[model samples]
Target chain A: MAFENYVNSNESYTSNQFYEKLLREIPDLIFQFKIEKDNTYSMPFVSNSAMEIYGFEKDFLEHDAGPVITDRILKEDVKAFLKSVLKSRDTLTRWNHEYRVLLPKKGVRWLKGSAKPEAMKDGSVVFYGRITDITANKEQELRLVLSEKRFEFALEASMGGVWDWNLVDNTVFYSEQSMKILDLDETEGINSFENCISKVHPDDQKEYLSDIDLHLKGITDVYENLHRVKGRKGTYKWILDRGKVIERDKSGKPLRIIGTHTDISSQKEREDELKKTLDIVSEQNSRLLNFAHIVSHNLRSHAGNFTMLLDLVDDIQDSSEREETLQHLRTISNDLTQTIEHLNELVSIHTEIKIARENLNLYEFFQRTLNVLSEKINKHDVKIISLIPDDIHINYNPAYLESILLNFTTNAIKYSNPERRLEITYQLTYEKGKKVLTISDNGLGIDLEKYKDSLFGMYKTFHQHPDSRGIGLFITKNQVEAMGGKIEVKSKVGEGTAFKIYFNEKV
Target chain B: MKKFNDVFVVDDDKVYHFILKNLLKKNNIEVNSRFFENGHDAIEGLKENSKNGTTLPDLILLDINMPVMDGWQFLEEFRKIKGTLNKETVIYMVSSSNSPFDLNKAKDFPNEIQDYFLKPVCLEDICRIFLN
Candidate 1:
């Protein structure tokens, strides 16, 4: 017996009515879709829920709802809906699809449909299916995908890598990009908090740890630090690291922290370059100020002398007296020319871009200087002692070395003590992997305490000697500095003086 | 009676000494003029004259930028011992420097330094110091 006939024989059970009531009560829109041999598509059976889902009347759908159903499906989804139905009919397979449909009362809504297809002996196919509203679920999925894409772009644009630290577990987790930044191999597994900290440069580790500690203790709103980290190929890169405590315990202690590391080495290099250029510019400014002072003071002294001599000539009535004053004027004019020449030499030295240099024997230069001052050395009965090795060589300008040697030697002879026999000693020593030449004399030493500040200043004389023009030491100091060297002096009153010249070998 | 009996000219430049002496002689301000090349010698001469009971110069023409001891150093030393001397001396600072740094520094020693004169000081400047 057929199951419907068997239930009908009892006359009390209404099987068709029971199933129709069940379909009406459910939330889904249940239906049977069909395709005939002539390739015509139709929805032969649809439940009453179509009224709620698509705003259609149940009576109208029960009659011939195929056109209304197709029309209500959005224009963009109609093609895919038809294509899926045809595919299921031809293959006699289960049909599954999600699509959008438009309605009169409501706007566009998402629907999901799933059904099983069966082929009939009359060359027709049928699909029994159900479709529920899936609009809310789809929108949530799209929003998630958009947020993930934005995060990916931010990391790629900044050359940043993410790091997560679980404070409770003391474990560190680095994202794939972080591994690339730290240049760690994939097999290097399970980084501990200590292991991650070891990658920070020793000089920067202190501040980096202190910053995180501050954030953990709630002393800071966010942990931010700029420090160096050991990077690829054993080099260091400056990193702008920032993080925040996302989770905290009841005691307000941090449980988890996440941060980003951005490579900022290039920015740090530019800052250092700016600082160095500023230093050089300020140094040049001070030097220019000093040069201006020299020009003003020296020239004014000569001009003032000329004016005084002219006044004297005007006041004298005698011709011989006037002629004598005129002779003083001539000498003053000569002195003015010499002062101008000295100023010109200083300007040239200051403007020199490249100084010529050669490898010269230091002992030979000293010997030549001694020979040139042989007459004065004998006249003063000064003992010239040379403790310098014959093979000692220096890279320097020839004229500068000769001039420096002669100036020191002559100054020693000139300032020799008259009461005591004077002895001048020259020696070469190596200090800090560089050559230092020392010249010592038992002459009248300067009072370094009183004149140390202006010892190398132009026209600064500390002695009453007739030959003390006070230009030689100033010029010697300029030459020494021009060749990337430095000079220092140690002296005491009534004792002796020693001049030590440090030569830069790398220059 | 002459207002100044003794004068001291402390300067390093020989030409300045010559011109000042000639100008003074020409002006006929008869006084025993003494000269020292530097501040060191000038202070030493002052101390020696004080020890020997000789009269200190009533007028001092001081120059800046001298060797061994500068004008400022001389003033510092002079301030320490000026009260011990029998006579009071007036000091006039003379220098070729027109730097405001030097001029402002001169203002710091008002009691020790009476005036600051730019160099090539004329006979009129000398007359003002002596005749005033």
Candidate 2:
């Protein structure tokens, strides 16, 4: 009977040894803990894999697990680990934690630990849990958070907008700066793709949609365009939308897109205005070239005629006929002199007034001009009223300003009505940092509809006056423009005329 | 100066031609001088002379400004009329354009233009051209 009992008992002991061998062969880091009185902890079992995870012998933990907690757990995480364990002790459920743990040979590692409660018939709790080293994954997540913060700061400081799109969900992700660029509040309702399209200018809506579609179809890797968007102030702003399709799946379907928006309204406006100014200047230059040709041909012809006439007088022998020829020649010579003088004056005006710029006192300049033309003003029975301020000033060529003022005042007097008493008034007004001077006259006003186009052209005389050479206004216009100023005229047939001059105010 | 059978004055202004013709006569140039209102008529007269085998103008006073064709255009067309008269004919371009551009252009035409004279071509200028 003793021999039979020894064989059965030995077989049972062999089966138990096989069970323990099977548990040790598993790859996971397994452990068993036993709860004691006074909230102390003990490990009844620990797998050999604990050596690989904690860099310690499994026997050390199994011998005295309470000391292992303090030795292995980092100094900073020890308190929290104890508190978590104590809080979950009464729950009779699994408790888990992620904390930094120090190893005997390894420096430090990120570890996850858990424990489950087991109830015995004696009301004592026992637990089992596993520990994992997740140091690489934790480092990767930390680096990603830092890079995102840097990108957000850069975008906000540059006043740029960043956006991302999820192709699978058909949803868009916008940074805080992206909302600001759209002139929307941070708390405003989320914008759908259709809402973004509606804000684009009507002329650009089709192009905007088509570009996105092309990008989505994987036909293009990038899309960029300039479009007008309504701002918070309800005014249109020009923005450059540039984006790249970053990801595509195996079947060539777009997965994600990233882009930025930059405000370029000021630059676009400057380009447009520059093109317009260039066109105007080109047209004016061509007209001047044509005028120069006509001037050369006409002037030379008259001079040639005069010279030939004088030569004929010298060839005549009879004294009586010679004297008569000389008399006619004198008349032609006088006309030629006047024409040449007019031409010389026009040329001088173009060259001389182009070089000089100085600060000018309007009050003094106007007074001097009036003094020079006092005779004509009196002869025309004109009442001159000056409304210039003493402190007003402008940057201009002194001689040009004098010439312009003289011509305007003289013209007002010359074109005055014979039966009516002429009243010429000068008024200066400052608006929005620009100086405006208006010279109004009660005179025989011009029919602007008929002569407006040629009013400031050389040799363009509309009135039937003996002294209307038509050069004064032309020179005035050139002088004004050369000084960075402009002139505008308003008139009616019989009522009156007003000349408004706009000039930059002296700071 | 050698006298010739005829002279031609081509210009638009009647006063210029009248004065030039009388001056030529007073200087005792002793030549039959004719006047044309413009370069077109003057060229026609020259063509008629060439056909008749008569001597062309001993000296042609060419004015630059005229109604139909000017002195420069006439010179271009005159070169095409291949005749014995061309070797003997002398041409003077008279203009009132005091621009150096015009003077430089005149000098560029090597053989067609004989000389350039400014406005008021007086007796002294004419005398100098012939004497030189």
Candidate 3:
């Protein structure tokens, strides 16, 4: 009734005057509607802006909205428009609704309507309201929603999830992908620093903590850690974690640390497998080298026999000596033929012995070796005084050490002073970061001044012993060098001889 | 008259001693000779014979590859006692190995190994040293 009073009395001017004033003063579409007792509604005042908004003639909207407005309202929003009108009809309250309209040439447009309702004494209702073109705001809102969805899709494709740890609040947020990488349920999971640390393998925790500390101290620009974290399946998985302090407070305290985690378990396993394969290849190479040495040695022995028989056949004098020489020559020929047959089958002298370097318990090894040579030692009454300490360990190949010790011990025994009990002393010490092993013996000492050059030569003998094939020292020297060590000798004619081996550890 | 008074043949190969003794006999060298099995036996014999002031060899032929003691090992101990010896003994180093390495090694011992002889020593190889 109050809105009707304004509509009926305040209309000092005619309906055309009020609408003409509205067209000049107002930029929005304005309207006034009155319903008759017969339930027919007519818009008494529909401004000229309606012609601009709906692209229709001003006379076209002056009729009851039953055909014009109802047909123009979007099909989907027609109920919302009707609901607002019905609420305004009974309650006599304000009507406000946003809806869409399909116009003649302007296509679809968005509009907002607001009106105050009044009841007339003639059992009719009147409404004075305004409709706004809100298409720009709605389009901008739709664009924002579309861009957000595109960003989320891109993140999912990258398998990347943002994570932020609020250092100040001691709280953590793991995005869906990040939670899934940590083996935590992506939909429902909370990852705090304590839980993350607990998931990390205990052995890697110290290194992880140290790296984080370095990053926190600003020593590193970013925190990087390659470590293993226990998964839901209870197996540890390797993770390549990279993070940086994304935000800091005024006092330079870290406010947030954001990062990403990549599952690198398969890559780490591949590296380990490659290393094992390399080890196998190296072992095979060593076996092949040993086979080559033995083959050469066999060839040389055969060649030596051939030359010896050739000499015997070249000279024959008396009939008795000729018969004997021919017989010996025939036997040597048979031996050489057998050696040639051996050449067809490649023989590895020490193929089964893989060179493994580790800390060697010298005392235990020395005792084991002494037992092996105990028979000869006891026969010769040799005293092997091991000056090496029980705790002295050397980084050397086990087989090389065994061969070197055996050669030195045997050489000492063979050249022992026949007039006295043989005395051999062995000791080990570190010299300039290299192990120096000295094996000295009070035996028939070598005349170093005369035979020093040929001491380590093949088939070069320094002492006259029946069993001296003159190959031991040469092979011993080779074994020492193959293990990255060097051998040297010092001797005095009547005093003694000492063989020293210098071994350096590989880093 | 024979060129040499006595000959010492030190070798592990019985064939060398037999062949050398036969060649010397065939040539009517009329030289007294002693056959030692290896360098050690020869060294000890020479030491004992020299200490007793007995006649030592005028010419010595030593094989390089003999068991118990090699020719090189004998030369080492030979040098130390050579000054105390009574006789002036000419030395020759012989080996079956014709390797250039062994030849070069023999060249180093001018006083001890006067000539290096390879095996299959025809009488000519020995005749060149004494008859020449």
Candidate 4:
């Protein structure tokens, strides 16, 4: 009677309602298998969903499921999966393995199979297993691992370090390479934010903290700053720290930050050295311009004088006055010879002589120069008015000072209008550690607009005077610049001219 | 040779003027040789002569470099004076400058300048003027 009842219940469970409920309950194909003699397997039951998984009818797999399993299991992964299962059976433990399976009428797919061992009362071992398709998940995991390897190679090649921060836990995670960059042992724990902060220079600590705070407050999505950090060798190195907030909370608050650090000390040093070299080149260029002006002026004046005298000698005749003419000729020739010697001396002035800085009395020097030109001033009916203070002095080269003053005085006399009496005035002032000397004249002034560029050029003459050689101002400009001074002119066509010279004050 | 109403020597150098005046007297140039220290003085004299309808110089020996104004500036101003002085009067540019630039510039004023002479004007050079 009990055997009849079991058969009757199985018949009722196979009804359409019962089968429909079973298909809905288990969307995956379900099967029950029983082991036979010598490596053969038998299936007593198979669900209708088996058609969806293996593209076969349930009746075909009802007696034998081994054919489907063997046929669908990829040739390469079958041996490994079988070996794992056998080993797990000997140990009487569960088995888990991921293997590729070739589906009928479908491409190959990866499946994760897990089997549980059941102990029977007859001392026989039986196994039940479920296979879940994990093809997409396995491919994604492989791609992630490859990308990580590429990032590691790139970081190493670029000499960069990677870091990650956990905002909620206040911990920092540094990669092995990052630890190496900080000169720290890779095995040491760098799991706390304090460990990273401790390596930063004291001066940069505030800035580094502010950058992190700004990122956390959602002020910015990225933080970049340069800071010096103490390396494992206790040497300070310049590092460019760049990071972006990667993980954010629902409120758009940054939960985690990750970034890189690169050493840029050598590049920074090269940039600073290049700037210093450029400054020196510009300074030398200014000096070269002043030197060129001096050469053009001095050389052309002597040449002009020589040419004029030679032309005059060719036009003269009469033996009676020939001797007197020869004497005048000798005087002019001597002047030319002296001018050439002066030019040679001026050229040698650039031979790196150390300048002797000393205090110089302006009034005393002015008086001395005035005395030297007194006879000419008297003959020309000229008056000199000095406004310089007696105690006021400047640090300068004495010879340069004398030359500047002499040139100005002679120029004033030479260009003076014959109809009016000549008057020259000198004034001195001090400002911002600089001494300024202003020499003004009531003689014929220069047209600054038209001749400003050529005023100090060689052989440049604006006045139609016979004595104009256009060298005095040129030499004066050179002397001033050689002594670390600067000169400027202000003049109009008929009004007089004023030369303002500035010099560094002595300590 | 044709006699000129007036002759002029415009030069900055005094020795050139002295030699030129003596040469003119020896040749009996039959003209009053006027001397000017510079182009400025020479221009003033020419302007005054033009205004008064006085006889203009038949010939002018002008120097290039002079005080206040140069021979080139004198010629520019001399052209503006509207009188019967054109075509009949001849001007000679005498310069000590051997610059080819100056020679080319003189060629531009061919109507005003009859000839260009280098320094140390000699009798033979003056004779060329009479032949022209």
Under CAPRI classification, how is model 4 graded? incorrect
lDDT of 2 by residue, B7-80 (tens): 67776555555565565566665667788766788889888988798777877777765544666668777777
Among these predictions, the greatest TM-score belongs to 1
Alpha carbon deviation, residue A214, candidate 3 (Å):
58
lDDT of 3 by residue, A110-148 (tens): 988888888999999988888888888888888988888
Q: How would you encode candidate 4's per-residue C-alpha lDDT over A36-130 as one tens digit per residue?
A: 43445555555566666656664674346666776788898889977886676668788788898877666887778676766556554567665
**CAPRI band for model 1:** acceptable
For residues A367-434, what per-residue lDDT tens digits would candidate 1 score against the true structure? 99988988998888888889999998888889889978888888788777788999999999999888
DockQ of each: 0.42, 0.15, 0.05, 0.05
Runs in model 3 lying further than 4 Å from the true structure = A1-361, A387-395, A432-434, A462-470, A505-507, B1-5, B12-15, B18-32, B37-58, B64-91, B97-115, B123-132
Error of 1 at A216 (Å): 7.2
Give stretches of model 2 more than 4 Å off: A1-27, A38-41, A57-66, A90-93, A118-125, A162-176, A184-194, A206-210, A217-219, A246-258, A264-400, A406-433, A437-500, B1-132
Candidate 3 CAPRI level: incorrect
Worst 10 residues of 4 chain A by lDDT: A1-10
lDDT of each: 0.81, 0.71, 0.74, 0.70
- Tell me the TM-score that candidate 4 gets on chain A alone: 0.52
What is the descending lDDT order?
1, 3, 2, 4
DockQ of 2: 0.15
**lDDT for position A479 in model 4:** 63
lDDT of 3: 0.74
Q: Is candidate 2 or candidate 3 better by TM-score?
A: 2
